[model samples]
Every structure is written in C-alpha cells, then in structure tokens.
Target: MATFATSDQLLVIIDPAARQTDGESVRIAKDVLSAGAAAKLCLPEGPEEFARALDRRGSRRPVVIGDGRALVRAVTLLHRQRELAGCALSVVPVGDTALAESLGVPGGAVAAARAVLDGAERRLDLLVDDSDGVVLGALGIPPAPGRAVAARPVPIASGRPWYRSLVRTLASRPARLPAVPSPCAARLRVEVDGRTVVDLDQPVVTVSVTPGTDGVASVEVRPLSVGAEATPLLASGRSVTVTGADFRYRADAAVSGPVRRRTWRVAEGAWGLVLPAGR
Candidate 1:
C-alpha cells in the first residue's frame, strides 16, 4: 500500500550525535535514501545548525536521522516555528531506538530509509504545555529519589509576597545547613479537566499521561503504599495539571524542570509522521 516519492520531495537531516556515535548507520541510511530518491541531505553539528537546516528546507519533507532525542528536538523546533502541522516528518532512529520504536518508527537504518520513500502520512496528537513545550509521546512523573528528583534547588524570582521573599532570603543565609532529607513520595494535586483526582494530602508514587488517537490524554496516578488491593486512579481528558513542591518529569527522552506546577493538554492531529503504508 506504500506510495512512491521522488528524492526531490525529501530532505534528510543527519543529527551530529548519530554521526559521532554510529557513522556506519548514518552512512547506510544516507546510501539508502540517496539511492531511493534525489533527496537533499543536511548534517547539522549542533542545535543552531539544525534549526538553520530546517529553515532552509524548501518544499521537501524532513526525515530525521538519529535517536529519540533528535526526533524530539526536530519536532520541538517545528512546533516553535508554528509550521509543524504543515510538515510530515519521518525518522530513521540510530542509537537507542526505544522511543522511536514506541512511536512505531522502524529501527533499522536501511528499512527506515526505504519507508521514508514509500510511506503514508499519519497525523499524530501532541502534548503542549503552558510554556509552549511539546511532548511527542508519553509524559511521566517517576518515583521520588528517581530521575525526577531535583539535585539542587533552583532559584525563583521575587514576585511573591514580602514575607515569602524574606523567608527565602533567611533560608539561604545559613552558613551551615542541616543535612538534606531523604527522598520521599511527592504530595501532588493532580487534576483532570478541572476535577481533582488526587489531592495534595495524598502521597503519590507515580503519574503517567499519554495522548490517545481519539484526541484525549489518558492519565493514571498511583498512590504511595496504597496496599496490595489498591488500584491506580485513571481518567481521560484533554488537559491534565499537576501541582506540588518542586518536581521534575520525563517527557519523551528528556527531563524537564524542578517546577512546582505543570499542565499538559492534547493538541489533536497537530503533526504528521510518515510510516509504512500498511502500518
């Protein structure tokens, strides 16, 4: 069921990381793509160059060659430019293909390149945050002391009440502070579509939110030590908000923030991906 595409219609972007880590794979992908179509190839050494390459891309479809992080970076750039909806991206995952595999992208270099030349475009949902950040796949708050735990406190601006600012100043003035406390479960206030699913008093073990094809995000919250019979709170909605003491979360392959609050909502069919026709 795959449709054919000419090289003139393709733009191949090879992430520098992929080239450094696996030159063979990058070469193989390039070879396949070159043989299949008369595509233009871009080898961006860093983020700025990557952006420039995309900006220079005329009417050709972009095919990213790298791992999951590269894919996320490309999508984020397109999203920021407000041109994501008009572009149909294809990815040839290089190193550590876990995230790409989850997104249904082929793992091998040659196979993925071939798919790019003969594939169907499928629009996919995205999670957009209040800060304009984009998440291509699932977002999760892992267990405390895990990857989400902040190593050090990040300074916040003094727009708060005078008393609160005074306390923050006093707390940082201590020459010798007490030992840092061991990590414990987070007390989060999780809301879905304006309804509270978990309150601040509840100790949360973990939380996960994934956008579905139906344009809704499925949210699941697990309570800390809720006993063997306890079940996770699950719901589906367009928006999900989590608030608590400073915490971080993993979105796709990246970890973002030691923020006190974050909200994500589904932007249905916000972007498109090229996949094998029958897939």
Candidate 2:
C-alpha cells in the first residue's frame, strides 16, 4: 500500500462545469497524483467549499485545477488570509486559452502539473481595485451603456490618456466594436493626490486606474474620444474614490457595486505568489 506524505498534500478545485464537460482532465490529474509520492490531491465540491478548504489549509501550496476564475478565487482567499507573506499559488489551467495564454501557461494540464511539481516560487504584484478587490496583472473597465459598452475592437491603452477600451453590445453578432462613451465618466470624479483632475459635467464612459507606489494613482480616463487625448495622471496617495448614481462596474473579471461610492487603498507587497521564471 502506497501512502501519501503530509508535505505532499495538495488541494485541487475544479470548476463544476469544466469537470462535467471534460471528465478526461480530472481523471488524468487524479492519475498523475496517484502515480507520484510527491503530491496528494484533495478536491473541493464547489466554489464556496473551495474557499473553505483553502481557509482550513494553513500553509500548503494550493493547486487549483480550473481556469482563470479558479486563480482569482485562490488569490482572493489568500488576500483575505493575511497569511500570504510567503505562500505559493500554483494553477493547472484546464480550460480557456485566454488566461493561460496571458500567463504563458502551457496548454496541456500534465505539463502545467509537471511544472507545479518542479517550479520555483516567485513573487508577483497584485492590484487592488477601488472596492478592495484583488486583481493580478491588468484591469479592464468594460463599457457601460451611455458610458462605455463591451466591444471587441481592441482599443489602444498606450499613450497618456490611454484609450482604455471600446464598448459594444453583446446582442450584436460578428462583434461590432464601436467607440462609445467613457464608462466611468457618468459616475466618476477622479482625484490625484487630493487634486480633482477629472470632474465630468456630463455622463462619461469608463475610468481605469493603475495604483502605484507612494499614493501615486496612474489614472486613465476613456471617454467618447476616438480622438480624446487622455493624459495619464499619477497621483501619490493611499485612497481613490469612485462615486456615481449607484451603478455596476467590472473590476478585473468580477462585477461589483451599485453603491454611491467605492474606495480602494493599496497594501504594498501584501502577498507573495509563484510566477514564471522570467516574470
């Protein structure tokens, strides 16, 4: 009888739908764990249960077996833990190429699993949204109607007032991406270091902020400008407030808010995560 070691304990949370759609991946992952003395896998029933499992897990490196959402759930849990000072996060991206492509994760689950067994832990910066939401890498503010809409034309976010993105309707087929209004203009009054930089008299579209060091908020405003010069403003401060008539906005991949105001404060180097060798 082969026994698993306590140090080899691993938690695997697979998305319910993904497991249903592709049973092979889960089966293969289980076999991979069974064949090795280095890993002992534990599966969570669902998302809520997954969180509970992670919470119960003191300091073990969590290995999530879903797509990007799984990664987000893990990060969010670690953020709430306050114990991520030196915890490693490993993911076996089993679905969708979007998130994995962005992270340079291999397309195969076995390869990702192999990397998990042999990879070194690296620290990566996590972004905090206005609502205290934790996001890895970049954040996208999807267009709101009368503000910015969800489009697929791929707007440029390069220059100062980087065109954050375009908004299009989900109903429209063939992905009709139109340059719409700013998503946050209707409800956002951007202030940099206590100085009001953008005060929208009319309804604007979207506002995206990349929070940086020393109270510096890298603010980018995307309005109805196919030609609007958006000057990226960096403000040094600890707080950022977004106010409106109670509207919903996308933070990272999660939808939050209908509140009058939502503010975000940065916690520098809050968590340590595992990343690729080059990153």
TM-score of each: 0.83, 0.68
Prediction-by-prediction clash tally? 1, 22
The per-model lDDT (C-alpha) reads: 0.85, 0.59
Mind giving the per-residue lDDT tens digits that candidate 1 earns over 66-162? 9989999989999999999888899999997998788777888888888888888888899999999888878989533544453566455566798
Error of 1 at 110 (Å): 1.5
Residue 133, model 2, lDDT: 79
| Strongest candidate by lDDT | 1
lDDT of 2: 0.59
Candidate number with greatest TM-score: 1
- Candidate 2 lDDT, 1-279, residue by residue in tens: 122242466655566655775679867765665465245455677878888877776545677777777777788877776666656777777765456446555557676665565555655445666545775544434334454445545543555432332223323348444655333346456665566656656345666655443334455655443475554444445556666676566654556666676666655655554444444
Q: What is the lDDT of residue 19 in candidate 1?
A: 92
